[model samples]
Target: MRALQQCLTLAWRSLVQVRHNPWELGDYSIQPILFLVLFLFVFGGAVAGSTEDYLSFILPGVIVMNLVFVTVYVGHGLNSDLTKGVFDRLRALPIPRWAPLAGRILADMVKQVLCILLLLGVGFLLGFRMEAPWWGLPVMIVLLLAFALSFSWVMVLVGVMSRDPEHVQLFGFTALFPVTFVSNAFVPLETLPSWLQTLVALNPVTMLVDSCRGLLSGGPVLGPALGALVWAAIITAIFAPLSVRALNRRLMGQGGAA
Candidate 1:
């Protein structure tokens, strides 16, 4: 119970810091707007036969990409805190060691939600419509956020291990670029060669995007959603404990060095 309070308090602190460093929100704000505009106009007609037709097909996929990319900031933020001796001071406090990492994840997940909402608002303005009912929007948001929260532990681990924020950002973009672009995010699997089709089908991002597409635009639900849930469970299972241990070790190492 005390730990939960500490975690929430730290989460609030991170959010408060954002207000002071308002430009920290560029990943959540400016980037999504650019992606929506540039991608919608550039690849829309080529892929979907028309700009409007492509908008419906690509908006959900773009949201998934944006969510995944913005999560890279989790690692970068942690790296910054570590470098600035924030974690050193936090370690001296009476709070649990995991609290800061957990708190950061919690706070960043909220940022991811805000990014998604902003993108969706723009998407709606661009003539996107949900064929699914009202409840579907909330359900899709929950699923996407859950995935982001779970995947964030991986970012936390990277942050704890790396000293440079840019290194973490580079690693994240390098890894996520292929995952996002190689799958069904931008184009149909049928459009790709048979060899790549298998990979696209097996991609968790593809499963996630497909589930969101179905929830928003109406299609198969159970299989893709369950697949995505399983992937989330696997990621959280592996990375959460690893991140906790990594942060603890990082704290101990920093203490010893001092």
Candidate 2:
């Protein structure tokens, strides 16, 4: 209970930073607008035959990609805090070791909600609609955020092991770009080569994208949604412990050799 409270306090601290420095939201602000507009206009006619059709097809996928991309911020922020000796100072506090990490992650989740809303607003203007029931839209938003939360441990592991925040961000793009773009985010998997179709079918991003597509635009739901949840479970089960161990290693004064 005490640890949860401490975590919330630190989470509030993370949110407070936005009030002081609003530019921290630049990525959340511009990236969504650019991706939504650019993709809908640039590829819509070729891919889905019309902007309206492509808007429906790509909005949920773009939201998933947006949330996935923001998870890298966890690593970047953690790496920056480490460099500033912030964790070293936090060590003196009588809080649980995981509190600070949990705090930042939770705060990031809140920021993600804002980004998703902003994108949804832009998408609405572009003719996006929720074909699913109104309740299902909020449910989809919650599930998507939970899915994104499962990615936090992976970022925490990368952040703890990286030499610096820039490296963290660099590694983030290299690893995330291929998985996200290569999947069914921007284009239909059926249109891809046979081998790429198989690979896209196996991609967790594809599962999430499909799940989001179903929930928001009305399609097959159960299979991809369950698959995405399983992927989330697998990722968190593997990385959460690894991230905790990583923090322990740092607490014991080991360098970022891992």
**Alpha-carbon lDDT of model 1:** 0.88
Worst 10-residue lDDT window for candidate 1 reads 154-163
Q: Scored by Cα lDDT, where does model 2 land?
A: 0.87
Candidate 1 segments exceeding 4 Å error: none
What is candidate 2's lDDT per residue for 1-258, written digit by digit as tens?
A: 888999999999988988887887987778878988999999999999999999988898889998898899888888888878888889888998779998999999999999988998999887788898777678778878878888878888899889998999898878889989989999999999997899899888999889888888889888998888899999999999998898788757644442
Q: TM-score of model 1 relative to the true fold?
A: 0.96
List ranges where model 2 is wrong by over 4 Å: 254-258
Q: What is the C-alpha lDDT of each candidate?
A: 0.88, 0.87
